[model samples]
Target: MHVVAHTEQPLQAHALIRAAASQPALLPLAQQLTDQCWGLLPGVHRLRFALRGDVPQNTHPASPPLTRDRLSLTLCVGPHADWPEFAEVLRAHTTGACETPVELAALQARIVTIIGAGVAGAGTARALAERGWQVTVLDAGQAPAAGASGLPVGVVAPHTSHDDSGVSRLSRAGLRLMEQTMRELLIEGVDWGCTGVRERRLPGKTRRAGVPLSWLNEHAHTANDWTHKAPPPAPDDAFWHPRGAWLKPAPLVRALLAHPNIHWQGNAKVEALRFIPHEAHLSHASTNTARWQVLQGSTVLAESSRVVLAAGPGSAALIATATEDGSAPRINPLRGQISWGLMADLPSGAHMPATPVNGHGSFVHKLASPEGPAWYTGATYDRIHGDARLLDSDHAENLERLKALEPDTAAALAPLFATVGSDAPRVHGWAGVRCGVHDRLPMMGRVPHAPEGLYMNTAMGSRGLTLALLCGELLAAQWHGEPLPVEGRLAQFLSATRFRSNA
Candidate 1:
């Protein structure tokens, strides 16, 4: 069982006083409890107390072992304690673990239908499948990572702010979780590289001036690395993140969807959702069994009591249809294009930086590919453009931005441009549309007022590579009634209900 200790201000002392005043026989024990717990750290602690005559004192062999039950107490001893998060944790522990309808019929198998086969959908599939639920993922694309997640290499790093905003904290937590996941699932150095990242500050930006560099070092820096000192070849003002890395999303998505309980159906476009109520002849108890149907045009594609909409820009339309509310949160489609070139084209001793660098545009070092060693750089962002077709103009725009960001690297590639012409490098690139909510945060949790079984986990923008796994875990935790991996405030910030008028 869980209990929250009244450790705020005079509450601790007041509890002790009330206990002693009400029961004079327990005065000594109440005083001892106060002395032992009044100054503990701010975290969950286990407490045990022996009650007189609670167990027999006999030492017989057949006598049951001393019966002991552990009490989990959440202690907050400082003014900075997150009360809302503490309350949520307390609620989860006290209410027991297990979601509603899934546990209603314990003998029957549970099934969940997830739409979309990108990172978000694949990650959610893995989470649910690991919990013994049969999950089937449907996607309109021919294969997974056929959307924004199809990027060859994407950076995974924590965001930092002077005030440590919600986005920063969430990204920090997400980065840690992603790092742990990569270690467990993907092959090191091949599928992912923890080569660290360098963030170059703009010429006039001063938001991070007064912030202590130690904060970044403590949170994301390795033991051997120190903050405030730029590594060789990078600008002196560039901030280094030792824990940052570059990941290949396709492999990660495939690995996540490889679970035995997960099934994938490609080229299956989900057109609409329907909530089918139980028939009148069915028993009242079975009425609580929710049913959702996934439709493609007039054809029924799939159905289950649980459904998750994670199809990026396509989720907004589905949500609007499912909830029958046209005012659902708007997910904007933002087009992005990334340019790449063969690393062998550069001069043999060219000063190509070993790590990924982020400034006006980002550059990734040589990564092994089927063709040969390749380098990625310049993902031009255009919010007004929604077209998925690749453009030579966009590729040129990427190279231009890269030239401004790293002049030396651009100069070193002059030979390649001379040999193959500038247009050759611009032709090799990829383009995709990324989804973004109006608030610029991911939309997660149950769809607002839509049935209990309907949910969403999309609109991740460009951070899908960094935030998808953690958000998936968060959704799974809520669905299973498990302790959340992130704080309650962060979860609420990304909640689907945030778009509701009454919320």
Candidate 2:
């Protein structure tokens, strides 16, 4: 079983408290209960409790509070079972408060009914549900992908390399998988397109050794390997293809919610998970519950022999909270910003380089804009602490850097950049965080030495659009006991086990 101790002073916690105390007169009772729990659990830090889903909800309650100010709130979650004994214990504690014991009991009952709504839970639920598994996706948010998946547009395409490398392999594979799935599913406005990507070769650029290269030919990139030779005119001819595409990240995430067998619930955050020899128990908080109670707010969502963790960066934290050994590779959060521009005209037939710009630390791509001829040149990779809000300085610097690469294209891109609301026609832009893995490849595979059931797929970094579908399939392979099509060496390259062992 895993235990998560989360502290929230604003928003969620406050909202939960307010909802419980909606009667106004119940404010004192609510505050008193919250205070009592907080005071007794000083070692709990901001919030503290030990949770093991293994203990049956039918387990009887302990005697009266060691003191009125001290109590343990256990909410039964996951599949509904006979939990009266456990429910009675929770009732025994909340007795003698402003409300009747029956009211408190009802509140505890409501806790287990709400489940969290998020991409990790929801996406997996959808995938499984489509396969005919009964699934429930629960989250603390009112919607799906409210965590790292909340990005407006997740940059799609391979990163760094175009072949065999871990990033490339996963990206190509993911792109193919997503394309296939979306095509079969027919969810519209997701904006799947084959917009070709183009790049201007720098004067003295060199490819990274050991990095496999593809698609570039006599005309693809401007050759700067030889000095004193002016680079050839940009590839105006439609000779090659490193074609790219974009997806409205939000709507696509929401579309995943359409699965029939998947139950998407919001305002419930998993507090704990208990692993029995054969079964697993889940503990979580809900909106309707007055205080935490076992089985009251809980429902057995799924009792699969396996469970996967696609929780993005939060997966590491969740794993850390659950494991007694406290061993799991931490996810690295990388921040990347994208700058958009209104283009007078993008080269009609020319293909752009969808791969990341190496030393320049930026990426440029085309966007489907209602306005005429629009392009997005972007993405400043800043690992340091900062805000997601776009910065003018970053914009100026990006433009200058972009201009230096292709002066001719810069002339055409400039006015468009300005008109978009910057110094040029480019007025709109955006920023999002990438959950990157320290090894620079995605983190995948089963959590090492833990129960065989737990699995993870995260840290796709700048390649979410190109990598999500592929990674999901990889996880599915493991869950189904099927041989992974990806090479074993590549699997090791992306394994979470590598980090856990190294650390």
Candidate 3:
């Protein structure tokens, strides 16, 4: 539980420092300390930072608040017996410099460490380690899931492309493996239940005649009788699912980190990756290690042979060195915002079927909440060039789309707009971003030109909870040189090669 102040290297510390120092208001204060700290410890092997404070300012009422007031920060440096002198330098530079740098750094690392942090990188590393690969996951955020993987709840489904489409096929295979992985992995308090997913059928035959479409435009009805206390006897003509599940994404992430084989260091951001014939060189925010190091302010944290860029969309920006014909993997960031509501008027004992209402890529699910009859109605997919802003217009558009799918349900669930009796039951919602691959399937293979030891298991797009387990297993198999569970051709469905093929 105690996250060491310094790891085998310094990259982790460096990332933590840069992220903190980059703050506009904090930059000036940090710069003064960094210049002095780095100069004094030219031979310093590591730097650590820890901050305790009140939350940050927030203009929007719903946005997560930032920490502010009564803050404490710690910085730790290695190879320096006189850390007090170094600590004095940081104290002189800050306003409330009560705590010494080294003292605080160790405390912060231990606090954050014991709480159990790190997201995709940690999860992947843990999985690989269970399979016997010594893995160290590097992250830039103070905590994992700070990036795109931070959604409170994520849609879980087996997405299919047009019939026999490569992505669809891959999704099917992935779904099967995912089911198996969930069973094998022990994730606690992670509510996972299968509800068949569906793409709704056209309302009536007449409406189908007017639309022109691509192969993805299959006119189909998706039916789940969970609306009624007793599902209508299987409609011979209805489309329904026998399997689907709701997953708590955060808990799933924590479960992935529980394995013994993986070691993780949060805030270890990688800026540049230099590929050698055998190993890859990582550039940390704090250290100029000949190899890699963690840094805080102007210090280093840790380093290792393998680094997985599981920072979601941010990985795209950091992986500029792995270009193929002027392009890295064709990963794009898609922002999805969703709203939640409580169906106050619905009949009791209504089983909320976990099926998707398609055509607009919107998905819905029912979750147990203290508030009555809560449902997750969301997700408008908007392609933004690195924008994480939760726009008001996006929310309105999502609500409008929901109206079209189930007008009565939309109207019955309208209380999210204002204060209502707490006992009446309402839906509370959230929005998040999903990392998508150009091929519409997840990218989960080793980076071709990078070191043979390096691998990538990200680009999960919209289905992280459903796909993460399966993708982890697939990657683990590849690492072991064992035959794949899915077919070879299907494996290519998820390859980075899609970034090149004109198709």
Q: Rank order by TM-score, top first? A: 1, 3, 2
Candidate with maximal lDDT:
1
In candidate 2 the C-alpha lDDT for residue 113 amounts to 17
Q: Ten-residue segment with the worst summed lDDT in candidate 2?
A: 39-48
Instruction: Please rank every candidate by lDDT, starting with the best.
Output: 1, 3, 2
Q: Where does candidate 3 stray beyond 4 Å?
A: 1-123, 160-162, 184-190, 201-238, 275-301, 321-327, 342-366, 369-373, 418-429, 448-452, 501-503
Question: Which lDDT values do the candidates have, in the order given?
Answer: 0.70, 0.46, 0.47
- Report the lDDT of model 2 for residue 433: 58
State the lDDT of candidate 1 residue by residue for 1-503, as single tens digits.
Answer: 22444355434444644665476555544443453342122222223233333432335443334433322233443343556665655554445422343543442347899998888999999878876789999999999888888888889876665665677667765776677668768998899998888777666522343223444544232212312335666776677777789999989988989988999999998889998865556676555456889999889899788899999988888887788454456789988888777876677787777688776678887798887888887687788877777776776676677676677887776555443335454237778888987777888888885766788999998788878877887898677654565556778888878865622
TM-score of 1: 0.77
Candidate 3: worst 10 consecutive residues by lDDT?
221-230
Off by over 4 Å in 1: 1-109, 204-233, 284-288, 414-427, 500-503
Query: Model 2 residue 288 lDDT?
Result: 22
What clash count does candidate 2 reach?
48
Better of 2 and 3 by TM-score: 3
TM-scores of the candidates in the order shown: 0.77, 0.57, 0.59
Question: How many clashing pairs per prediction, in order?
Answer: 0, 48, 46
